[model samples]
Each structure stands twice: as structure tokens, then as C-alpha cells.
Target chain A: MSDEGIDEGSRRDGATELLPPHVSADFYLWLWWKSEEENGKFAIDDGRGGVEVYIDDRIALRSTGEERPSAVLTGESPATTPEARAAVAGGKVPRDIRLYVRRDDRDYHVTLRGTRVSIAQAKLPAQVKSGDVAEVLYDRMFLYEELHWIVACLLRAFAAVRVTAAWREDLVPRMARWATLDEARAGG
Target chain B: MGILKGALSVRRYRVIGEVPEGFRDLWIDTLNSHQFREPQSSTHKGEVVGWAQAHNLLDTDFTDLNQWLYDRYAYFALRVDKKAVPAKLLRAHLQKRLEAWCKANNRPKAPAAVREELKETLEMELLQKCLPRVQTWEVLWNVNDGWAVFTNDAELPNERFQKLFLRTFGLRAVPWSPLDELTGTEGLAEAVAAAGTTDLRGRGA
Candidate 1:
């Protein structure tokens, strides 16, 4: 609730990185690789079946069991958006990441863009049923907690994971062939 | 604004598992098979989940003619309503009933049988006054490309939806975990395997 990740008395389910930290190139790279492997059907961990990642396939053809929608990105699909695809191929990492966390019935939706998260809801309990606003406050609290856990899980898995040096070396040449931009080339 | 708008928050799930050809027809059959059990006034029947548009499930299940076109979406909802006597109010009423029953039966704190009878009487009286609190969760399934955007994130709702989805479609909606959960890196298992004999563990072994 305080920030990303679930706070137990101690060990939480997500990454323990600082808030507002820019997502690293490695995370995207790893995600792309994983997407290629799974064919774009994967969910976010500890998401309790809440948050999921749907990959757009243009480059990686093995990610689906069927020949449907995997080849071409949909109009509004972020998976294979030009910028995102480019970034995954050899473009710079996205400026920021956006995650949408929601409860199925509650009136509010939380938008977490980068370090800032804002909840937008029209039916405030205070406006609808004016007594104690604890339910409303608690709803907000639950929303924040869920988002923090998702962000933490994502950032931690990527940032804190210790991949072998051999993998980095192997990734470089493959990346060099794909990337066009200097930042991507050097970063990869 | 609500579960149905452009500017709303939702956990996006890639619809895993094969949704067979003629999925609409299959879906209608599934919806009818798993229609929700209506809430009753007797017990603490907490919630129920099923088709948002039961009528559609009965017919062609078409929200728009565009469903026959591109970008088709289906609506589903989880409704939670309870009809239970308020515990505190029931307890107080029970106490009064118990006192009156004890006086009528000429016992200090009525025997177990008398207490049970009085409690049942009070329950019948109080059940009539109980009001069910209603909650509904709506979600959209982009049936074409296989995307399920759930509007709520509560554990109960999510769990119910998972069960409901399986019952309705015979498909698994696993909470999609990212790369780590899927492949399980365990500190780059692929890289270490590729490293072969020269790897660190190789020397130790």
C-alpha cells in the first residue's frame, strides 16, 4: 500500500526497487523473449489472476497455438505498437510503463503511469451513501495494494533477478543485429 | 466511469486455451448450461455469477450486429446479494423473545428446547425485514482476439470468475504471470544450461 509490492511484516511478493525508477532494457528484452516462448499468453505473477500481459506477435511467430491474431497487431493493441515493437527490436525502452489495475465491480479504476498512480471513480460512497466513508477509503486502499503488488512483482522480477553473464553476452550480438538506434545498440 | 468505458481500469488477460470455431454458438450453449442460481432469503447466500445478458444467451447472443463483424465483445457479470438477518439486531430480538418465552414457560432462562423454538420464531419474523445488499461486477470478453478485461480485482470475484469462465467455456483463465512465473528463470536456467561445463556450478561439482 505504501509503495510497490505487498508489505508483510517483512518479505513481500514483489520487487523491492525504488519507486519512479525507469524500467530497464533488460526487463523488456526478457519479456520479449518470454513472449516469443509462450506465444503471448502470460499473466503477471501474484496477480491473483488480476493483471495479465498479452504480447503482440509480428516477429515471434511461435507464440500461439493458432494462426489467428498473432501475426498482425490490432489497431489499438500496445503489444505490437510501432514504438513498442521497435523498442523490443532495437528501439529505446518505453518512456514509462502503464498498468491498469481494477476490481470487477467497484466503481473506480486505477491508472498507474510511471511513479504516479491515480484512481478515477464517479460514484464516491460519500456522494451515494453519506455516513462513514470507511468503505470508500478501504476500497481505495485495496486498489492501491493490488497495484503496488503488480508493479513490485514486475520490477523486482526484472531488476533483482540475476541472469548469467553468458546470457548477457549471448543477448548482445542478437540484439546488435536487431537494434538500429545508438542507445539500443549500446544498451543491448 | 464504469465497467464499460474507454477510460476504465482493468486487468487484461490473454484468453488462453483454444476457443473452438463457432465459439458464439458454443458460448450460448455454455451460458445456458451454467446459468446463475438465484439468491434465496433463507440462508447467507453471498453471491452469484453468470451471464450479464441472459436473454442474449437464450437467442443469438448478439449485442450488436457488429459482433458478426470485427472487434466483438461479450458482457458477463458477477452479482453479490445477501439476505440475512442483522446479527446484532437478531441477537437483541432473540434475547427479548427468550425472556418472554421463559416467563410464559415458567423457567429462569428457558430450557434448550424453549430457547431453540423462540430463536426460530424470531428468525422467521426477522427474515422478513432483512434487505439484500446487491453488488454487480461486469466484464468484457473481446471474443475475436481472445482478451478478457475484468472490471474488478477482489479475490472472491476473481476466483468466482475463474470458476464461472471454466464452467461456461470449459477453458482455463489462469491469472497470467509474466516471464518468470511461466518459464521459471531460477537465475537464467536457459543461460546456465547453454553455458554447459564451463559454468560456475560445473567447477564446484
Candidate 2:
């Protein structure tokens, strides 16, 4: 690995300019693999009892082709559906996903965009509604920062494994196996 | 402010370029120089974009550093006040004026010069009577991290904010993209450049 493509990748237009090759899509796929593999439990090293993540009802998958055809799934655990696995078998990667994260006895809902790896429309864990303006502002900022920390840790965890040879020699094969197993179960 | 309440929506940008030492006093001056002014008092129309106090939009005063600087972060709001005259209303008023001009000047229709003047007059009058629509986007800049969080997702406003940021601080605000995030990690630079998107279709499927 060299710095040859770093500048070139950044120079590309649209979402491609923001990510190395397919890293964003692969990152989401890797998350999905982890979710199912470890029953949605992730020890992100946040000091407290780690976070639990689950892919919610909404998901969008895009194929690796010139046209880049995409399938958007919504309603009741779409991530575990047969079509989702079938799409993966057809080389479709996760584009956008609704995620449910729980940590420290609190729950959060957010949308993760694979194209830029941004967390949008985040509904954070509830805190006491304070009367003081400064208190409320500080509380809000703290919650937002905590959410950002959790997300950053998740990406860091993924990057640690993703940059390794095991991702190519082991992880991808396991994920492919999982997708194929689901496809067979669905008779697709 | 969106940052203080409601569902969180933030777009982070890494502030490129360095700020000189003693930026506190410098930035306070810079912020005051770019502070919001009354559109009605000035000859400006359409919309006026400027920095406003984070706690209060009406308070354009930024003399006190304690008002905005909290710990290692700077907080402010980008205020845009827009005043627009409705097209239909302007058209109707212009038509009446045209008729009035024709009758007064003893002609079938008013001349082009007169019509232009009438339209401009009507627009200014309508603009004056109409109250401006004010919209503010909260900006929280982590001075230590060199990243700023703008509590907005709109395209046009974000573009305006970026331009204003560069003009005020003499720095470029690049969107904090995923690759940009990864590049900050110690051992990921080469790995990021080398990694390509994997297609799992052929591996086992």
C-alpha cells in the first residue's frame, strides 16, 4: 500500500471523491457482518459497557455496475430478509441504512450514509429537560459529542480490521458465505 | 437553535489553513466587522447574511469573548434575513400604475422608461412594507480539533457559510468526508489508498 491513489481518490467527483474506492460501502457491509456474527454486540472501547447495534427497517443497496442499480428496503427487519442477502450475492453493497444503537441503558436511532459515512437524523438518548439555557445547551452538545465519539469509534474499529489482510483472506469469504446461505434458505 | 434543541443534524468541516497567534482578539474583531446589520436601515435588499450571537439573533454585539468562546469551542449563528415582494402582487400593482400613467400622460400605455421606474418604485415600497424572513443556522467550531459543526444540511446556506467563513477567518472549510476521517488515523493512510471496494458475489455466493 502506497500513497499513490490517495490524492487521485480525493480528486474524483461526487461521493467517490470522499472515499477510497469502495470503502464506504464495504464499511457498512462489514458492520452488517458483525451485527449478525456477534448478535449486534460491539465492544467499541468507550469505557462503559460498549454499544449494541442493529440494522433497522430501512436499507438501500446498490450494485457495483456502471448503472449502479439500487434497491431500497423498508418495514420490519429488512436487513435480515432474503432479498437483502440476494442483493449482496449480486454484488450489491449497502448504500444507506437506518441503525438502532444502544449503550449505557440508552437507545439511539440514526441513519448512516455509506456514500460519505455520515450519521444523519440522529435521535439521541433522552436526558433531563433542564430549565437553564446554558445547562440545556451544554447537555445537548454533550449528547451530540457522545454520539459522534461512538460513531468514530465504530469507524476506527472497522478500519483496524478492514486494513488487515484478514479482511480479504477471511472476512469477505465469511460474509459471502452468510449471504449465500441466506439465498439458499430463500431459494433465490 | 438547532444545536440546542430538536433532532441533531450536523455537517462537520475541517478548517484548513492556520490562524495566527492571539486569534481570540483577532477573531473578535473579525466577527464584529462581519456582524449583522439592519437590512431596512441599509440600501441592501433580497437577503443579508452575517454573523449573529449564538444565544440571541438580535444581539449582533460580539465585543465580549465570553459571549461566544466556551472552553475550546466558538459558537455563533449564521443569520440570513430575506425580503421578497410577491410576483403576482407586484404585477397587479404595476398594471394599476401603468393604467394610471396612461390616463395621466394621455397615451394608450406608459413608455418603457416610465414602466421601469414604476416597477422599481412599487418593488421598493412593497419590500419596505414586507417584513423580512429570518433564518439562522448554528455553528459550533472546535478550535482545538480544527473542525466546525454547522447545524444545517441545506446546500445554498452551507455554501454561503463556507464563503463567509473563508472571508472572515482566512481559512478554507473542507467537508469532513469519510476518507478525510480515516486519513487522521495513524496507520490508515496507505491502507486507505490501497483498499478497493470488494464484491462479495464471487467469493462464496
Candidate 3:
């Protein structure tokens, strides 16, 4: 799959930019919009066979395999939505795009494409907080959950061994420590 | 330590001496048998072996030897002298040790917002509440002198338990019990028959 979106020249004046249309005949592209409360938009242009657009990982639109290039915009409006405008202005241009292409008869290929635009120039709403720590917390909690499972599995295995009392005793505290760490990390 | 390996190696070290003959079959031939067929080199098995060797419960050779025995016997349970240390206590201790190690590693703590989100996301409170239930199941299995017990109670003997044993321990069904290989028989008749000597009709019916 090939993605040719706006280049540095397009960012100079916010002018009518031309993104090099992606060309693929046998795959579907999905656009995901993650926001507090607004639907997102996505468009695709298939040069030969028509393209399919998926929203929230589900098929929202499917072209009739027409040779004419086509695009599907997700959400209610692609160009005039408040969320989209804010996203574009923040230079965080919806790069949450995924491409799926088909190969041969039995194989399918998937790829992630799209560029991020900086919205530093856009004025921010006074109500919106700049340093939102939720993202950071989410990431840390995810890591902790993963680590907790690992430690629990290890401890359970240790118990199954029916080993020496001394060694088992020695390792018990260690395993517990790991569990505690996992809980702490998970923000338990 | 040496005693532990010897116990594990013994074809059958009685957990409760004078257990019904069929009970042995149920434990070793059935439940224990299923435990051995679990995925190879699973973290649980590895940890068990590692702990055994580390604690001198078994010699270095004991690891390979025990594994080989598991391959041949299908399932083997060591009769640990509970007077020394109960398996539950041992497990709890090991968990504590691992927690300590995690602390020493000095990984960053989860941020408060993340903690709250994760607690909600992973249902941390629910998991914590469930931990006691899980521990209860472990205790039930450890104490019971009859057939090995499992956590999920709603699961019938022949289907879910057997499948779970196989998955958890990597042991295969020994084809000794008629229900061991039986399929499409999920009703009480099949369950009673799988129970071997349980007279479902005589006592209850």
C-alpha cells in the first residue's frame, strides 16, 4: 500500500492541498476516531477497484468495485465538524488510519498510514486543559496489568513444582513482592 | 528437598492412606492424568521445577527426571508432608517475594489518573474480590483426599474438568475410563458413569 498525503509545501498556507491518492485494488482501509464525544471522518480513493471504508473497525461503506476512484467520509460531516476542525488545528490530524489490502485468493494485508498535522497554530479553548494526564495514566495502568499477570503465572508455577520447603519459602516472598508491585503498578 | 523429589517420583505416594481404590484412579488416572497433558514448558511447570531444584526438593537431574516421569505416567502428585509447610502458605510467600523484586526493580508507579482508569478498566476491585475465591479453590484441591477439585463448580466432571485438566497440566486422558474418550454424552447418565462408582439411582433415586 502507498500513502501520499500533503507534503511540507501544503502546510505553508493551509491552501487547498492535494494528498497523493493511495492506489490499491484489493484491500479495505479503516479510519478510527478516538475522541471524548464526536464521530470522525475518513475518505479513500481507489483508482481501479472500488475501496471500502471502515469506522470503529467495522465496515461502514463498501464501493461496488467500480474503476472510478471513490472516498467515504465517516461521521456526519467530514469538513465542518467541531472535533475534526479541532483535531486539524492541533496538528494532530487524524493519522488514526488503517489500510487493509488483499493478496492472491487467501491472503489479506493490513497497514497503518496517514500523517499527523500540527495544530500549534490553532487557538486553544480556555476550558480545555493542555496537560491532560489521563493518557499517561492509561499507559501505566496497561503496563501494570501485563506485569501482574506475568508474576501471578510465575508464582503459580512455583507452587506446582512441589520443591523443597526452604526454597519454596524463600521464593514465596519474592513472588508476593512481584504481585504487590503489579498491584501498585496497576494502581490497584 | 530430597524427600520431595523422591515423593514426586514415587508412582503414587498416598495423600490420604486408605483412600478408596477408585479414588486413586480418579485422582491419578483421571485428574492428575489430565494435568500432565498441558502445554509443554508452561511457565507454571517451569516455575514448579525451578523451585523444586532450587530448594533441593529435587536434584538437578530431578527436573528432567520428573518431567520424563510426567510424560510416562501422565500425572504425578507429590505427597508433601503438610507439617513442614502447606502449599497455600508457600504460594503466598512466593507471591510476596515476587512483589518485593518488582519493588526493587524501581519501575515507575502508575499515575493516580491511570490508576483510577486501570482500576476501572481491568476491574481491579473485582479481581481483588475474586482472589479469595480462587484461593478457596486452591485450598479445596490441596486438602481434598478424593478427586482433584477445580475452581469452576458449574462445570461437569467429564467435559469441562477433563478439558481444563488437560489444558492446565498438559496431561492427556489415559483412556482407562469409558468417559475418558466418550463424546456427545453430556447428560447425568454420562456424568454418573464417568464418576465410576457413584450410584446415582440407588442412594438418591
Which candidate wins on lDDT?
A: 2
User: Candidate 2 has which clashing residue pairs, if any?
Assistant: none
Off by over 4 Å in 2: A1-21, A45-49, A62-72, A86-92, A164-169, A180-188, B16-27, B40-43, B64-66, B95-114, B170-172, B186-190, B200-205
Model 3, residue A73: C-alpha shift (Å)? 75
Best by TM-score: 2
Looking at candidate 3, what is the lDDT of residue A147? Answer: 26
TM-score per candidate, chains pooled:
0.47, 0.79, 0.15
lDDT of 1 by residue, A1-188 (tens): 23222223212112212122222324444545444345443455554554443333222211212222223222344553445444444323322232223333433323332211212232222223323333332343344335435544654454433245644465444443333233334566
All models, RMSD in angstroms: 17.3, 5.6, 31.8
Q: Could you tell which candidate, 1 or 2, scores higher by lDDT?
A: 2
The lDDT of each candidate is 0.44, 0.77, 0.25
A95-149 in candidate 3: lDDT tens per residue?
3233222212211112222211111111111222233333322332233222222
Tell me the docking grade of candidate 2: acceptable
List where candidate 3 sits over 4 angstroms from the true fold: A1-188, B1-64, B67-74, B77-122, B129-132, B135-161, B164-205
* Per-residue lDDT over B1-205 for candidate 1, one digit per residue giving the tens place of the 0 to 100 score: 3432234444444466787998767665666566555555554435544554412322333334333222365655555555677789989998988888778878887878877887887877776776666566655666765656566654566666666676667665544322223134344434322332211111111
The sequence of per-residue lDDT tens digits that candidate 3 reaches over residues B1-205 is: 1111110100001122233444433443333332222224212211111111222322222324333232112222221111122346545654554455447767445445644454343333333333221111111122232223222222132233333434433332211111111222233223222222111111111
Better of 1 and 2 by DockQ: 2
Alpha-carbon shift of residue B50 in model 3 (angstroms) = 16
